[model samples]
Target chain A: MTTTERRLRTAFEDAARTIEPGSLAPLTIPSRRRRGTWTVPVAVAAALAMVLVGATLIGDRMRGGPPPAQALAAGGPQHILAVRAGRAVVEDVTGHRLFEVPRAEGRYRAVAGTAREFFLAVQTTEDTYSFYRVTLGADGAPSRPRKLPGPLFRTQTGFGKPENLAASPDGSKLAVVGTVDGHAQVDVIDVRTGAHRIWRTPEGGAITSATWSQDNRTLGFLWGPKAADLRLLDTRGDGAELEDARVLRGSSIRSRAPGFGLINVFVFNPDGRTLTAQVQGTKTGDHDDTGYVLLPLSASTGEPAGRPVRLPSDSFFVKTDTTGRHLLQIIDGRPGRVEDGRFSWISRAADYDDAAW
Target chain B: MTLFREHQLSLTRTALMIVGDRATAEDVVQDAFAETHRRIGRLTDHDRMLPYVRAAVVNRCRTVLRRRALALRVGRVHEPPVWSAESAAMLGEDRREVFLALRRLPRRQREALVLRYYLDVDDAEIAEVMGISRSTVRSTIARALAALGRQLGENA
Candidate 1:
């Protein structure tokens, strides 16, 4: 059966076998939500039902239990964002907003790069970098963000293009990814030490994104144009391809602007084989301008290691990053799909990239 | 209005997965359904109510978590779903691994992910539900994905 047909059957079967007229509450008069939701709502309601309960419960325990003593009290989580004031909003049917923050001062966009803990966001006026942390409550009131200890001491390779700040879970290290000199680069700063390093895309252009391995031993990201390649930086191991770069297997679609292409490396699956992103019509971060695409990574040689998967074309792709490689990724295991039976996309569209959630 | 009941058993499970406590997940789902009923009309689409409700429960839980952070002033978040590793295996492959990894993310990242992928909801919807602007949704998702990708690529 076609994927669509199977999904339809699954939806119908799920609906028939499990959906009680009463269980559903009256269906909302269809309105702006489809536009608001990507494609039709996810087809696997029955399966997700179990996940729904488990997720909420787990989330609750994490919330109520005494604070985890494991976390060091000295340094906290550091985050950066490409914050923009009210461009779009997340709300439910009656217009009661779920995300209840101030009509923000600005929106924060995440700059994804190797597992640099914090983004070295320095105002143009200063070359030094500091850490910023803002705590957001479910009620949406944000605690006044405070700067953490130490400061960055180098110019980033992203050149501040996708300027972003992030802190390691332990809050000991911070990485800042952004465009510098029109190129995307990531800078790593020792939260304990003033020491830092500037990682520039050797090929040129903005760095689309970057990530660090579980051990934080290797860092990888996308950079350059048609010849754009995946760059891996190893802090302690030899992780780079023999050629020093692994080119993504996909067409290079130019951005709406002539001579510009807006393809980014979305996420390197835990196995580090699959990538998800949108080849957009423009460079700016607007869903109006983009759709999701899957890019498969193979050995530096162009061998078909596995089939490249495409997200349901109707589905809109968001710009969020999952946590450490050892971190969990939401997956859909329908046989031959994203490996480990997991798909990493989560919640509606995540805000401000992943600097914060 | 009783959609939570339709899937209450499962919702109970989902909550447990997130909170790591069966009893608490049941309470959360029950409350979530009640909240969903209160917010029913406002939720807009019938199709998305399940995820909406799920997101709501998860959001509520995350709310509790933020307070925990403040109580400590600085520390950690992210505990595995309640399922034992073996029992967790009973879940669909995608849900188990990803959710496990997701919990590893900062609370905000985990919340952003649940709303983004689990519900297959859009950024605007997430922004509305999370009460943040769409731009922030975009930023969080981007960073979250990058974080996941990096962890997967280099470590795997």
Candidate 2:
């Protein structure tokens, strides 16, 4: 063998020795998965199920609850923080530029926060990110950007430099998905104390579309390569491992239906019981006619709970305002509003990559 | 099941070389064994079971690397078994450097080298596990050795 081959063999042996066989846990065989045999029962209950669903819809209408199609457009916030061409600006609901957050080092990449308070992150270096908070005055003028106190984050590489940043509905906590030593990590930071609780991934996978629930403690995110399903992480839990987050298998539209295709973007409705997602394909597998639709999925089971709202065009961004009724959607680079089950263009095409109300 | 029990540790160690961590490696192996057991009724040839499980483990490892998202939740912090500074300390600088260099290789090249050198499997077995021809296995291992040497600043 050559000297290089000898060196490699020795190195491999040394590395293998690090794991002792005695340390391995006993094999825990997985239990057999029982197949469902409920087809006959399901068929028998189909008519009754439809009647019950119709009654529930009528009850919801009588209670004056927002229609599922227009639930996210109920009362939208007026001011928004958006990142456009490396600049962070506060804008009105109509896409009119209101006030620009003062520029510092690095390019602004992400904007997430709610109400009068918002947070943005700047990619200071490749893989490094820093957070800043911008609070809007009553008149909608943005305050000077305040740098958040914390260690700079080593975010995953690529265009979305902030990885995924979501501030709690109350703006009291911030959850940032980043990387530490090449492994994915989620760090939840307390806005008041600047303290951090980190959850580390045991393996590698891209985590995106971070959305906070109404409780301000449950974090919902899309874990991907396939964008399979949305996963939930409890921020208040003491666990420091990402596995502490439960995989909501039902939250995945693709698994819910074979032809659903990929879920491009999703957010938790204010009630935290439904996920509003922009999903591709249709149940009939008619890919040519139907492109994409705004879908509301059960947060727990990923089943479609409401009729899909058709978009004017393909949309990659969707953000719900504090009321959970107001939705701001970006389609083909233009901002629009999804209200009363209809989409109306609200502004000319903008260069913004991300925005939040 | 007996074949899996006999080779579980070695297979996991092989998977660790591909996946860069022990938890995922073990998970990959366990899933592969469970799958093999699930399909045992379909297998009439007993001799092929070991090779089938090895290929399954390797394929599952590839899936884990591709999905790249670790969704498992634990109650405490999970210190990754490799690449971290603390793991580097445990692995020693020489082996750490080698592992790091191995990680930089393409997935196929890295797998080829691991199966050959780490598992000390012959070219035929490497081909069987990797689903490539014996000649391709030899060529891949050769290219991997040269590439690894270049990264390690050594003469191949």
Candidate 3:
């Protein structure tokens, strides 16, 4: 079977296991009079009303309040770096093309960085990814792609290429995460010097969505065999093992009470006290209710801290700017930004594989 | 009654993927069985009884969705079905992504996919269950696979 077919079968089997045979109620057939009668309709109507009222209460309580004003304004992030068909391109907030960052070889799989400074990962081989730095000039012209020397990142096939590059707030350190020999590895590179620090998951796991705290010493990332927990790693610590990283208290995707459903991507705000995450809301039957909220989680506890800003359906990525006022969001491969808690699509097509501001 | 007892769990689980919750799925399966039982005299071909009951379950799920839509239009909206905590625990993150992408598909596409993939039924059976031509089943499954792959960021 193909990957799609395999995934479909796996998903079906997993969902099926939720209803065990032993747990099922006894089967009883309704009589003829019970089916074609007014009494049945009346009973169903009453039951439906009660269920609806209960649902309304739950929805109201979980929806939370409107988002904060300053954090959502549209007028943030002067430029965005996006990867299209393995090449890097620059675009305005409205998604108008400015220019492409010319590369001689390799596909640009991931991107990160902020303001005029940006980093791109060019896949030089099947599993090897080389890093490069690009800086935007005052006139918005991108400087030539400059290769950064150090250990290359490894992105294996089964793990699905994640957001593996994160540039620190001061641009002094670059964190790269990927897998090698089935073990998760993170390499933090010092920009000024070619030296770097390395941390590895000794057993096995896949790491993705790495972000930097303002302190420049704390790196937060999603670690997985399950990849459900968001872990905070101290770069300044002596240990090179990933076990030393602290799993934020409530970061699991399975967090039910006071929790957000699936968080596909997240980034630290400028303050480093909170994280803005794209959360999938409670799903309805056969309805694509994904990407319902961009919620803020307390950095220490992993619990929700503030009101969640609603997002366009299927929005996955979230990039926060330095001021923590503006945000860049990608909905179903189309780039957009949130302003005043409202989402407006950039005029670009939905071809961007990855983008960052 | 024998057939319903034999296949109750499997059929109810199938309905769960279509309707999105356990309780409603069980109800859909039960209603299908009850309707089948009520009209057993008309089922002359024992060989095709399973497919017929499967079709009934699919049809009942469609009705449930239709009623929910109508309720929304008339300003009597119920809470959307959520995967229970147990269901969520059973599904992995990757499988959950697959389910979310599946939900985004059109109703017909979703139906065709569940019939072909989840049911593991052949094209002819899917056509019979969906009340479409065999050729339409093939095409619909093809289109559904491509659309689902695109949404999941993969090439079918």
Candidate 4:
């Protein structure tokens, strides 16, 4: 080899020697064998029965006020999973706690769920966090908490204390936001394979919240403390590549002056074509008196697509259920269902920190 | 499994050169190993295992670089890979400068340089591993060497 080439190889080898081998967990080949074929028929029968019962209960719910407790005993999608008083509680539409975690960890910070499972983010240490995946049983009771891979360090995005983790609609991936080398990043983990992809915010700001699109290809996250705007990152690449990120600044949503407001909470609508955001802004001239408005935004452009729906009360957060049919607003620490352009009281104002359906 | 056990460390070192971070490099190697294991039954030629594993590792490294680039474009702060004090001391200033500058090169150029110089693969092998044409590999390596020379203040 030429002298210069020899030096380059030598330098690389020298650096390579410094890295300790087996620094990552050993790979375990997943078992491909299927187990328990007999249970399938019985499980299928039970699921069909539950669906019939759920449809009946939902029919009753649409007719009038909250359905009786017996109707909610079936434990369907109508129930809200919330973090209240350091506990993970599953409350019915009427705000009655149906199931609660037996041994609650540190206060539950944020939660997201699909039809089959609930993913909870809990603050375990002063600076570290943990995750729990709870599978829902037929009776609507959550099974024993199965801790997911975490002890992930936390990074505050100034958007409030909501744990910045979200699950995809299909529940195949969990996007958890954490700090790496002092920079905030979102790590999208494939739950089945344990394969993960990390996407660090280009601006280095803490991501306040993140939600995946219905297709799971687009990720919408709140970026700012400086240029507080909703940004959409296209995660469509060959397992390892990501398309260029698109910043959605609905022209109407930008503050007359820079840094006048922040898009606090955002979630893609069920249709995946648009989104809803809770915007907190100061009056143009008066920097004092802040107002919160629920604004509909174009999912493609991040611009205000419809008229701003002013919130009646000072709600701290907003979320949509997996079905995208129910919108829950947290006002005075209590969750109320929003329908027909109005907020209807569902659960009494309590010390609930986060909620998901 | 035996192939993995025998050459895992060497494969990891190769990945580390391309990725710059130990943890990420290890993950890349582990995934590549897992992938190689899954496809092991399809390999009719035993001699081709090492080449297959190398290509897998290199491709995984590219995936990581793509993610980093996406994050940077969206205004997310990227923390450059950290090097241990011992490694830094061993590398010294000139080697460290070269290493840092190497990472700054475009992904294709970086891979070409590492494969040619560190792995000591010929242009034909590099083209096969990189999934590019032989002429493309030649041009890429030439351009990479020119860039390196400019960064290092020496004819590479």
Candidate 5:
């Protein structure tokens, strides 16, 4: 490097070496993974069955009559993971967590919707099954676990794996997407009264993830082997509100997938009418160039109401604010851990490019 | 590793200068140390820790600055509406001159200068951290240097 370059570089180095610390205190208390300690013995088979029927019927009731469910044009928080002692603490937005649940523990059990609500969860360790009712406070911190009530599904232990945690908009029902033993299905649980309903998805397809809408009229899920497609369920309990759900298939995850998991960015616009998602591109470098699609909430079957609108963000889409005005996305190319707190905001239109810098 | 006893004050001062907020700067500095702690083994070469710490601070500054801008646009709801503590008391002329010059510059220019002159990041690494093409990173440094030269020149 030239003399001037060396001087400039050295100057920044000296200044950088002398930085103070962040004003906001970090989350430093080490928490133990003691979540799954609560389990009221429910016959495993019974719990599964109740979840199946309850999800179908309750979701139908909440659907408020077959409204076309929208898609998350720019997705919300993908995965809620907590690390205790360098291991992921199995927890959700609600206070409930399958603490100490192995990395991939738990059967097809229903839990609360997001970090916002609290509900029930079931985890199976080998032959033993543990159930807990997780309560979340207004502050979003999880409360102590209470054993789940009602008859558990009578089935072989560990039949299904927890896929997605989606709740009805009314906060009444939560859909736990998982496999029944080896069968792909969605288990529904009622929050206010502790009821269970489930729908056996014969497709046995893997549910990549799911998101609930603001209307509570629909639940959207992505299910597939490698390519993920969007599916909607009527949480209103009226019927399978599966009309107009579109699957943008074969999209490659081209960005740094940090804490977001290998998730397809599924975001429900704040207006609660539209859903947006990032379609992975073929060539994987940065998802910045990948396409996106937006689907509106209208109750017409066979394909989503609108075309998938393309977003111009260069990866790191966090969540959409309630107003739908600003889009939060992670800023790319940093030197910290993959999950380093780096993100930016852009207007739905004219938003992603220079604003990212 | 640059031992804390030797470099702590300098790191704190530089962070304060860039962020223009004491508490935030301290936090940034602490975070830089924590990040260093995590990567100490990966750094391989002990001398490289300084650059890594500098990069971390620049990135943190960008984060805090972006957060400030967002809070402002979001109607001051997320963060409490108040001037940062660093600017609360009146600073002497030299500090104020530096602060005002920084505040007047565009975000990228200030960051480029901070990384290039303050943090002492080489152009290539700065380019990587900032997510800009190297050429743009270089241009950003050039423009920032020219502006700083003029700003400091006027006072001289």
Candidate 6:
């Protein structure tokens, strides 16, 4: 080695010796605790139903006029399905609970939905997790929950720790990042047919999150623990080979410095040419240190077309509404609408884990 | 649990190199251990636990750095790394300049140098821990060394 290089290495080694890790406190492992199963009370369900109907009427009267003609033309006001305290509650943009899951059997981990359907990941047993799809009736009431056909996921690391699950905009397909046969696999299931296609990571790195493009033909997901890269897998082709999936070479959302940043949420714009991501900037502090940005990508090359437009900081969760016309974000536990490069709060006191507009 | 007992100290020291503070480094390692414990049942192979925990530590340290960056951007006062008298005496003046310059480098370059010199890991292992390609690791280490050489006024 060169003299200078050797000197540099010696200096680093000397500095590293100053840390005495043995003096740190020992790690404590809590006993394995089981989450209690939840069942919605019959009386509570009836009361909630009454309150929902009453709220609809009261909300209409508060508007000082009839419901918007466009809303009537489109059937009704769009609903946001949010899971709070193990119960999935459907609410409108004004934060009124429309209805809730009846006889909720398990703790709801994560939720994804469309105007017509709601998909929830519920832990039925200590280790068993399953997805349930509840169709919304014309009156905005949810139908009897039906278990979606797929391999059961484990709640070993909470509901959505190492793996993330997302449903297509139309609610026909569900994409999940989970383990299959001792490997980290991405499974795309045709919710109706119960048939699935799986893509396993060759290097054994875990897939953190998955989201379907608006067109429902492509699935975008984040891979790895540190310095996780945003990868795209084309689901249009037959699921015959792993080669069908390719990492977007230059589309890393964070700094290459491992663990400096993370892309928490990403979705394709309605046009399918642009991508919006809730990216945690490479800053060290609290969990709320992240931002939202818009990066236009080349449809053909999968590369970003231009520089990203940074939204507001601390906007951790983002999703587009059903019509894909408006962008919604959760900032400081409240819902906000993003328009004209600004975020305006929509609801006053809403604390939700996930919301689908 | 055994993995924590075996590698916790080494991991903390490695984190200390990246985060440049003993308390944050310890906190980072503790968080990583807690997370690893929570997800331990999902691990397919027990042998991979150390690497997994190591990567988690690095990622947690990055989170700390990220928060620090945001605080600085908003003009918030943050505590600088506290160097003990014993540490200062051991580091001396020339090594202290090098350490300060190391902290000033971009996160990626600093990580590359730490992994290459302090941990003495090769490109392949570094790539796995950093979640990058081996080719990227090679280039990153080379660039980092060149930058360090320039900062130290040494011919590369």
Q: What are the root-mean-square deviations of the candidates from the true structure over C-alphas?
A: 20.6, 19.6, 12.4, 24.4, 24.7, 17.2
- When sorted by DockQ, best at the front, the candidate numbers are 3, 6, 2, 4, 5, 1
Evaluate residue A43 in candidate 3 and report its C-alpha lDDT on the 0 to 100 scale. Answer: 96
Predicted model with the maximum DockQ: 3
Tens-digit per-residue lDDT, A1-357, candidate 1: 212122222322232222233443322322333343533455467568879988988998989843321211222222222222322222221222444323322333322223322232333223443344444443434455444455433343312223234444344556555545434456666656656666554333334445444444444555433234555555443332223334544324432221233344444444445444433222112111223334333424322344334343212222233431221111111001122223333233332222222
**Candidate 4, residues B47-133: lDDT per residue as tens digits?**
767677889999998888777766666778445453334446766765676686575455766888888887888977887788876
List the global CA lDDT of all models: 0.41, 0.70, 0.72, 0.65, 0.44, 0.63
Off by over 4 Å in 3: A1-75, A157-162, A224-227, A252-260, A285-291, B1-156
Better of 2 and 4 by lDDT: 2
User: Each predicted complex: what DockQ?
Assistant: 0.03, 0.10, 0.17, 0.07, 0.05, 0.11
Among the candidates, what TM-score does chain A have in each? 0.43, 0.71, 0.74, 0.67, 0.44, 0.66
Per-residue alpha-carbon lDDT of candidate 4 for residues A1-357, written as tens digits (9 for 90 to 100): 322345577778777777766654666665555667888999999999999999988888789646332322232356778876567888877778889865546667678887678887777776566677887665558788777764454543211233357788888888765445545566787766556777664343334457888997777765543343466776655333222446676222563322244565678887888888776564222111246577777887776776666665445366776555567776645667765455567755455666777
Q: Which candidate has the top score in lDDT? A: 3
Ranking the candidates on lDDT from highest down gives 3, 2, 4, 6, 5, 1
Lowest summed-lDDT stretch of 10 residues in model 2 chain A?
Answer: A281-290
Candidate 6: Cα lDDT at B34: 83
**Docking quality tier of model 4:** incorrect
Q: Assess candidate 5 and give its TM-score to the true structure.
A: 0.34
Q: Over the true interface residues, superposed, what is the Cα RMSD of model 5?
A: 23.2
Compute the lDDT of residue A31 as modeled in candidate 6. Answer: 68
Model 4 chain B, poorest ten-residue lDDT window? B147-156
- Candidate order by TM-score, decreasing, is 3, 6, 2, 4, 1, 5
Query: So what's the TM-score on candidate 6?
Result: 0.53
Per-residue lDDT of B62-142 in model 1, one digit per residue for the tens? 555554445444555334333346434544443344444444444554556655544456877777767666655655565
The lowest-lDDT stretch of 10 consecutive residues in candidate 6 chain B is: B147-156
Using TM-score, give the best candidate's number. 3
